[model samples]
Target chain A: MATYLLLSTLTDEGRKTLKARPERLQEVNKEIEAMGGRVVSQYAVLGLYDFVNVVEAPSNEVIARISVELGSRGTVQITTLPAMSVETFVNAIKGGR
Target chain B: MGFYVVLTKLNSDGVRAIHANPDLVSAVAADIQAMDGKVLEQWAVLGKYDFCALVEAPNDAAIHRMAVEQESRGRARFTVLPAMDMALYVRLMGQSTETTGPHPWQIRWPVQIARRALRNYWIDQHVRAACQPLTVLGRENLDGLARPAIFIANHSSHLDSLVLHSVLPAAHRRFLTFGSAADRFYIKGRKGMTKQGWWNSLAMATFPIRRGAGRATLAHAEWLIDKRWNVAIFPEGTRSTTGKMSTFKAGVAILALAKGVPVVPVFLEGLREIRPKGTRDVAPGPVTALIGAPIRFAPATSVSDATYAMYQAMEALRLRLRAQRRPDGPEEAT
Candidate 1:
């Protein structure tokens, strides 16, 4: 699975939803896992963004679907970034055919 | 959560995202909170930047973490600046007791003005007169452009603001406050900001405005306006990548309508070709400054109408300039 970093913020309705049901966040995380993505880490941040998520998925199409699915829920706007660990990056760049 | 400013520029992917779903922007903000930041305020602005968001983070590490997440993606670019309230800013300003003022940048008044004048003269000599041949039309229209007027122009290149400032009469030029992008022009940190602030104040006659219409952005411009200084703003917010005009933001309209100042629509041509973004070549060209007749909206006119008329006026000015070129002379029957 490829790693993806998701930077997100809750919408007005999303904020209301979170305030009304704090458990909803965990439930949504479970839903994301069900969609074939695993949430490796998550952080609630302060500044132009609200949430940062590190996730793993099988492919670009899977992540695109995930971003669109979650974003379409009208609760959170998501910016998904592809990411890799430094070790993996170095190994790739080393290039042994 | 501590306050922070997020400056963002949308790439082609970002543009497509928004085109497909405008609500995606709000969702992205929610993503920030999910990342551990609280987006306190956000604005979509015209200019080089797409959005400027003020957020609150628990600490530097949290924001840095967010930065890493955002920057790793090619969808958009972000410049994060830590923010302090005015009270905290003043308190920090007071940390410097050596000067009569809170900051050294504010202490010097006369010398800064002299340096600015000299710099403008240099800009005139090297850039305006010698290197670049800048033409002027309807100088008579500027006759009525009084002090405290708002000069609204379309941004096409780095030279646009300077060209507008240079063409202004000295009486107005000395008092003109240019709106400059804070992230691009100045550095962070107290000492760095102070030094850069002073330099910008002198060189550009600029007041740094974050890329969007945050609460502080227009307020700062209004403060400058109230001080009887002429203010120049690029309604498009950023320079045009392809040398075409972009939509004018309502900020200029609101500022003019709220302050009851006459808006002088200044159309600049050939600036983009002369100095495109990311290009070091300052190619010589005939830069035309078409100063439209000053527009003053009625007290009851809405901001949208005023802004629309301003844009139309600018477009018309450009068209009129284009039509004026003939073998006899470049004189247009205005």
Candidate 2:
């Protein structure tokens, strides 16, 4: 599984939707799980970005699909960044992988 | 000198810049200080925004300049919301700070003398007019009673005060002061005593008793007791709209127990029919004031026990009054 950081910002319509039905957020998380992704940690942030989610998916393709599926709903804009542990990165740098 | 809640959202470039030099966070705080604003609290929170900052500045224009200066850097968007202290906000919304209690002058001799004059020439006539054919029972109960006692009664009407005053022994009437509702009688948060309040203080010998004031209301009453004056209180706190006796508040028990004074139960009957709660028109009906024997508590008696004893005494008097009931009058058939 690959780790990824998901940054999300709500659109005007998205804010209205969330304000009306906040439970839709948890529902979206369930949908992500159904698409073979696991949300590890998430925060409802205060600034330009509405959410910061750390997730695990089978591969980059699955994460990309998850982002596209969520963004297509017009409620949120998603930015996914693949993450590697420092240990893994250091090992790869040392030609140990 | 004003507070502002500054919501900041870091863009991609800003995040990269901060990642390169985390000291930029403290540097921004320093910048705010240089601009004559103090950053009271800053938190990197997880939610709709990246950071929330509470800042204090001289005024709105000063904070506006501070926000513009920070936003001009293109690092983050600043949403500055003006904030006011909750207490100041409530005060601005017409919250008052009036002290409503028994006035010091009410207990003075001059006021007492004036109150006696008002009661004799004006109030007694009004009471007699309002409660026609008023029957007072057990005046002999107070014949040899001690001074500085608490008169506890069951309240059902506004005329209760008038009737109670009319029936109190003439010797004690000059020294008797009644505990009246502060909210109803006193102007809240006013700078000076109101004219009506002065009239009540001089004429009715009434003092302000705030609801749920607990021991605070007892302070003036205790002072009056120490001065060898009687304090009459409706333990029910307010007139009962149901024409039934409401449960007595325990402040009377605390006052009586603390001062070691006798609790004299005076039950006023049929005043509700004359002028009950929330009505102005008087029916000019027959009313009875039954002054029972003074109740003295043992030194070791609990407050609840003393309160219950006072209530029971009043209840017993009420039952006795009911037993002697006739269509014409409440006078016993002796």
TM-score top scorer? 2
Fnat by candidate, in order: 0.00, 0.00
Model 2 spans > 4 angstroms off: A1-97, B1-99, B120-122, B189-195, B327-334
Candidate 2 lDDT over B185-263, as tens digits, reads 7656445434456667777888888888678767888898999899989998877755556667789889988889998
Clashes per prediction?
44, 14
| Candidate number with greatest lDDT | 2
Model 1 lDDT tens row, A35-93: 99998755555566676566789988998899999999899998877765433433443
Q: How far is candidate 1 from the true structure (C-alpha RMSD, Å)?
A: 16.3
The runs of at least 3 residues in candidate 1 whose Cα sits more than 4 Å from the true structure, single-residue gaps closed, are A1-97, B1-112, B120-122, B129-131, B189-195, B326-334
Interface RMSD of 2: 11.6
